[model samples]
Target chain A: MDENNLIKMELTVNGEAVSMIVKGGRRLLDFLRDDLHLTGTKEGCGEGECGSCTVHLDGQSVLACLTPMERAIGCSVLTIEGVGSPTNLHPVQAALLDEGGVQCGMCTPGMVMSALDLLERNPDPTIEEIIEGISGNLCRCTGYKKIIYGIQQAAQELQAASPAGTVKESVE
Target chain B: MLYRKYEVAQTLPEALSLLSSHNGAVVRPVAGGTDLILQLHERILSADVLVDISRVPELRGIRLENGQLVIGAATTYTEISRSDLVLKNAFVLAEASKKIGAVQIQNMATLGGNIGNASPAADAIPGLYALQADVVVCGPNAERRIPITEFHQGYRKIDLNPGELIKEIRFAIPAEGTGTAFYKYALRKSQAISVVDAAVCVQLSDGVIKHATVALGAVAPTIIRSPAAESVLIGEPPSEDLFDRAAEAACQDARPIDDIRGSAAFRKYLVGVCTSHAVRSACERAA
Candidate 1:
């Protein structure tokens, strides 16, 4: 936009200020993986055919492969790396670990990203909604039954934990 | 081969200026860049300069002005599906918009980009045709409005010029006696492209057909209206016989090809089936 101005973008990623010099064509997935060293958002298909590169763009789930870095300049981004660790666990991470949801773990982050969006929209979703939520994400392993099972477990855990106070207001 | 440098245009004028300067140099306006990028990856299409226009705020939102529902060219399918205005006033548009690709695709794929792509199986073409939408196109020097029916010239060609870009799509809201509906026949419910889709908007006068616009897609090189079928509904009483005749006539306008998605005969059959459903849906809404 500002050819001369050379946009100096500043954003918060995983609760940290992330500043980077991004071109118009640089997709957010590339910037995160290359510059920020956050390889959790795996790139399955760079053209958005697969949701393996899903990430939280301003708290909404989107395919990072299609999202331009310029748009994420001022937005909040959260990848799988930000969600939880092997030691400390988010409910989804915990459920995914507890269940055998991690087949190859290639599409896990994207599935989690999409499931997070689903939970935000429909907290107590049916099996169909859960299936619909992760349909965009392509998982080569687990036959998707385990992933669905993992989501159900996570929903139960999240519901019991009572995130009404933790869950932010809907962006709708 | 898919790799290329990108230039983001924050303003409409700047984007247009690039278009004017580039003469068939493989420059394209990127909205969601979903389909375009995939086509490039598969070596289906090629572009040198991807003029990023996603940041242009001018090409977004839906509004009602002068009895017409005006939608910005860069508005996403997700935005269209979620808009209460589209759900109430332009339900057919919303219906088709929701069925496009999946959630990730819908969240980024723009309505104008889909229309401009000029593909044979575009989900929104029939809906826009049923609405009688006017595509407002802007070129270097001036702008003009072209009806959606006449926008496509061939299978993958459009009426757009070298320096032109679609600014907005506008159509008059349906009248009090009119009801609109759109139906898509895809392999999968949400993600798959349409095998055959139909949009029917009917205007009835006390159970008599006052006017009818029946549009069908994916059954021909481009989306088309069955003049033969539309004529039969001019003054006839809405009934099963009318629907049968309309569907039959609608099938006559189709010339589908046997592709990986479906066979020519199957698509033809779907034209009739979808037309019947579309007519029934609109009739129910009108009733």
Candidate 2:
């Protein structure tokens, strides 16, 4: 490939502005994983059938595999790596751990990302909303019952932590 | 690489110019690349250049002008599904937009992409067809408006000229005493392609059906309007028996083929069932 074909993109990833020259046709999934080493966003289905590569572009959950790298030129990208660290987990992540939402763990990042976005929009989503919220993220293991439970638990945890009915500052 | 070059056009004219310049190249305009990227990934389609029009301000809004809803072609499904104007004027379209895929896909998929793809199973096309929408296409030299009912030419094919781009989708607001409904029978409740989908718009006057439009998807080469089914409800009063007969008529109009998602027989059965449900619900909403 000619180097001139590569476009220069400056985007904010995980709250940090980063610059890179990339092939315009590169999928955001490949750019994140291979270039930025954000492997937390897994790739289960390259065709966008599976939402394992789900990430937040401009605060909305989107499949990275189906998004061209050029689309992120001036956008903000939030992946699972930015959600919470291993030591400091987000409420949704902690709830998943407490509720045993993880079995194979490949879909956990995407599920957590989807759940976070859902909670951001609807803080106290019902069980049905939780099911619909995470419907895009599929998990072959855990049967999804525990994932629903995890989201429910997260909602309660978030509500209790903020008496004013606002999400906790830690989530930000 | 799937595309050797990618150009982001700041304006509609710039995009048209790029298309004209790359007339010989396999170039595709991409707004929300949800479907196009998947097609590229599956190797069903290839492009030498991808002209990114997703950021064109002129092609990304939803507004009501002169009592007609003008939806910018690049408006995402997320925007349509949540638009109050769409909810008040064309709720069935909003409902169909919500059912296209999950939140991720909805956030990235545009109505223009859905219509441009011209997939028979496209969820929004049936509702658009029922709404009597018009598609506005602009090219380098000419602009044309094609009715949504006549937009699709065949399986995965649309009546779009080369170097042309969809500008907006326009449709009149449903008048008082009119109700619209959309129903989809997919393998899953969400994030699944429709096995069969139906959209119905019915206008009632003096307890009689004054006007009716019934459209079916995923059961034919293109989203089809069932004139026979619509004729059944035109002069008749709303009744379960009438809805059933209209559904049977809709089934006769459908031309489904066996596919991986479902068999032709099963799809045919769904056509009747969904059509009846859609008509009944639409009538109830109208009353």
Which candidate achieves the best TM-score against the true structure?
A: 2
**Global lDDT for candidate 2?**
0.91
List, residue by residue over B179-269, the lDDT tens digit for candidate 2.
8999999999888999999999999999999999999999999999999999999999999999999999999999999999999999999
Question: What DockQ values do the models have?
Answer: 0.36, 0.67
What is the Cα root-mean-square deviation between model 2 and the actual structure?
2.6
Candidate 1 docking: what grade? acceptable
What's the fnat for candidate 2, on a 0 to 1 scale?
Answer: 0.78
- Candidate lDDT scores, in order, read 0.82, 0.91
Candidate 2 colliding pairs: none
lDDT of 2 by residue, A1-172 (tens): 3665777879999999999876667899999999899999999978777789999999999999999888898899999999879999999999999999999899999999999989988887888989989988889999999999999999888888876736634432
